[model samples]
Target: MLNLSDIFAPSNQISNIEVNKESAKINHSLNVNVSVDCVVIGFDDKELNVLLIKRLQAGDEKAYSPYKLPGSPIYMDESLDDAAKRVLVDCTGLKYVSLEQFRAYGEIDRLRRAEDVQWLERTHGLASTPERIVSISYIAFVRQKKFRQLTETYQATWMPVSKLDDIDLAFDHRQIITDAIRKIRRDVEVQPSIVFEILPRKFTMLQLRAVYETIHGEKLDIRNFHKKMTNLKYIVQLDELEKDVPHRAAHLYKFDRVVYKRLRGSI
Candidate 1:
C-alpha cells in the first residue's frame, strides 16, 4: 500500500507547474495589436464637415483619387493615442489637438480583399491575416480656419457630413464617421463645449440659435431659445452688434466661462 504523502505529492507538483504555464500563455495573448484612425470634423459656412485625405501609392493609377480617413497601425512601443496623433500630423500637419475615442472595432474578417491584405503588409510590414484588426476610432474637433491652413498642401478636403451617406469611404470608415457625428450631436445637448467648435468666437443670439437648429435639423422658437440661453447662462453679451448686414443688427455674445463650468457639471 502506498503512503498518503506519496500519493498527494506528485499530483500537487503537477498542478502547480500547469498553473504557471497557463498564466504565461494568458499574459502573452493579452498583448493585442491596436490601430488608430481619426475622424477630424470641422464646421464651415453653416455646414458640418469631416476631413479626408487621398491615398498615395506606386503602381496604382487611381491612388490619389479616392479619399480615406487618416490612419495607421500602432507601434509596438507606442500607445493608441500617440499613434493617432502621429497619423494626423503626418497626413494633415495638425498637432496637439484634442481627440475623443469613439469606438473599437474588432470583428474578424473585417478586411475582405487580397489587395487590402497586401497593402497593409507593404505599408507597415504587418502580417496580413484574418485574426483580428481591433481599431480604435477617434474624433477631433478643429477650427475650420486652422484645419484649412494645416491641410492645404495635402490632397485633404473638408466634406459635408450630409453628403457622406451616398459616398463610399475606404475601410469601415463610413460607419465610424456616422457614429462620430451622432455622438457629437448628443454631446451638444449635454455639453456646451460642442458649440465652441461650430460657432465663431463672438456670435449673435440668432446665430447661436441657428447653429443649434442646424445640428438638430429642426427649427426652434426664438422666444423659447432665448429663455433656455438665459436659464443656462452659457453666453454673455459682448456689448457689440453684427455689422455690414442689410437687416437689423443682432447683439453679439461670447461664451461665459463661469456659466460653462456650472453647466458642464450638470451635463
Candidate 2:
C-alpha cells in the first residue's frame, strides 16, 4: 500500500553496519583444546627405549621429576602435523622425523583426573584445566643414530619400554604408549623396514635377532628365526663381515628396498 517514493526514501533506508574484520573472523565454538601426543620409540645398545620428557613445574624451579609424553596444543595458524613436529623439536631437538597418527582420544575425563589436574596446574600454568581433551596421538620410530642426537639429561630421558610400568608417566600417556606398542608389534610383523630402523644400515644377523627379540619382548628360537629370515627374498645377505669387535666377526646383511617395494603389497 506504500508509494514507491516512500519505500525508497532515505529516512526508511536500512544501513549496513560495519563489522571489525578480526572480530568477524573469530570462531568461539571451534575446538581449541585439541592437542597432539607423540610416542617416540627408539632402540640403542640392544635395548628398546621410549622418549619421556621431564616437565618442570611452573612455580617451583626445583621440582622436575615427573616425566610425560612429548605433547602440545595445536596452534591457531598451524596444521596438526606442524603442531606435532613442533612438539617433537621442542622435546628432542630433532626435526623431519617420520610420524603416523595412531589414535584420536576424546573423553570428558581425559584431562579431569586429580593427578592430571595437579600436574597441569603445576607445569602448564593453566588457570582452569580443560574438562575434556581431544588428543591426536602419533607413533614414530627413531633410528639409533637419530636417537643419539638427542641430548640425554634429566630433562629428556630415554627409558626402556619394558620398565615403563615402574615409572609414573603424567596424564593418560601410559595407556597411549600401551596402544602404540600393540600397533608397532603388528606393524613389525608385516613391515621389515620397522626392524631396520632400530638397527644400523649394515648389521650382523645376531644384532638383527637381538633387535627383534627386544621388540617382541620374548626370546626367539635362533634356528627358527634364521630359517624364517632365509626364506624372505628381501633380506640380502652380504659377503661383508664385522670388523674390530670383541666377539667373532659375523656376516652382515641388509634389506633390499627394491624387493621390499615389490613384496610390500603381498605382505
- Candidate 1: misplaced stretches above 4 Å? 1-32, 62-65, 113-115, 125-130, 151-154, 219-227, 263-267
Candidate 1 RMSD computed on C-alpha atoms after optimal superposition onto the true structure: 11.7
lDDT for each residue of candidate 2 in 3-81, tens digit (9 for 90 to 100):
4223323332211212244664432121236889888888774877888887765465554337788886664445788
Query: Which ranges of candidate 2 are over 4 A from the true structure?
Result: 1-32, 58-65, 151-154, 264-267
Global CA lDDT of candidate 2, please?
0.72
Q: Please list the C-alpha lDDT of all candidates, in the order they appear.
A: 0.68, 0.72
Worst 10 residues of 1 by lDDT: 10-19
lDDT of 1 by residue, 24-142 (tens): 53221111256788999887647678988765555775542256788766544457887788778877877777887878977776666455555555454333333557789889776
Could you tell me the lDDT of residue 6 within candidate 2? 36
Task: Give residue 178's lDDT in candidate 2 (0 to 100).
Answer: 86
Candidates' TM-scores? 0.75, 0.81
* lDDT, residue 261, candidate 2: 83
